[model samples]
Target: MKYLSDQMLIEVYHRAVDLQLDSAFIELLRSELDHREIRIAQVSA
Candidate 1:
């Protein structure tokens, strides 16, 4: 679960940069990435 979410976050991040996604969509992705990062940190810690 963690790995998949992390991979998705990376993919979305790249897509946001490479494709120049809409600001709202990018913000949504950023929020998702933030949540995923927190989850990953908790799991690792």
Candidate 2:
């Protein structure tokens, strides 16, 4: 699960950087990533 989460984060980061998403969209993606990380931590705990 941790590995998958890390992979997802990397993908999101790449998309944000490579695609040059607008600030608003990037912020939204960051929010989603934060939520995913929280969920993963909860599940792991």
Candidate 3:
């Protein structure tokens, strides 16, 4: 996971969500993102 670039990491996260993968797996992705201090923007209505 560390080897993945920031863009790749975010892409993987999005892919996982689109595929409806397991929550644990998704959490792992989030954990990695947090570890790298990468922030994803949130759109509020």
Candidate 4:
């Protein structure tokens, strides 16, 4: 996650949502976003 750029993270997040991935996995992405202090306007997972 540290190696991924912010844009990459955002892309992965969108993909996760689109795929309807597991909630726990999505939560990890959300956690990374929080760690980076990035705020997403909304999340539908």
Candidate 5:
């Protein structure tokens, strides 16, 4: 297996969202993960 960088992962994620590759239910889950990551610095402070 190969590892993808955060940027690559985000790009792929966005592409998936654009294409509606995942079911409707998964979009919220993906949003939550992105939210958690964006809030990491605030949480650590």
Candidate 6:
């Protein structure tokens, strides 16, 4: 179970993607998500 709602998940993932300043490397990760909200147990920067 997650504390965040669907919209929150979307927002969080977008924020994570935004932090990927390494534009070249981020392409693959972002493409994998494909504009979908990800439900991961935890994300570590």
Rank the models by TM-score, top first: 4, 3, 1, 5, 2, 6
- Model 1 residue 34 lDDT? 81
Q: Estimate each model's TM-score.
A: 0.59, 0.47, 0.84, 0.88, 0.47, 0.42
Q: Rank the candidates by lDDT, best first.
A: 4, 3, 1, 2, 6, 5
lDDT of 1 by residue, 1-45 (tens): 355557777676666666777777766766777876633322110
Better by TM-score, candidate 5 or 3: 3
TM-score of 3: 0.84
Candidate 4's C-alpha runs over 4 A off are none
- Write one digit per residue (lDDT tens) for candidate 3, span 1-45: 979999999999888887888889988998998899999853121
Give lDDT tens digits, candidate 6, residues 1-45.
156555665565566656854655455444444545454543444
Candidate 3: C-alpha lDDT: 0.84
Q: Model 2 segments beyond 4 Å from truth?
A: 1-13, 38-45
When 2 and 3 are scored with lDDT, the better candidate is: 3
C-alpha lDDT score of every prediction, in listed order = 0.61, 0.57, 0.84, 0.90, 0.50, 0.52
lDDT of 2 at 45: 9
Clashes of 4: 0
The stretch of ten residues in a row with the least summed lDDT in candidate 3 is 36-45
Considering summed lDDT, which 10 consecutive residues are worst modelled in model 6? Answer: 35-44
lDDT by residue for model 5 over 1-37, one digit each (tens)?
0265556556655666666675553455455547647
RMSD for all candidates, in order, please: 8.2, 9.3, 3.2, 0.9, 8.5, 9.1
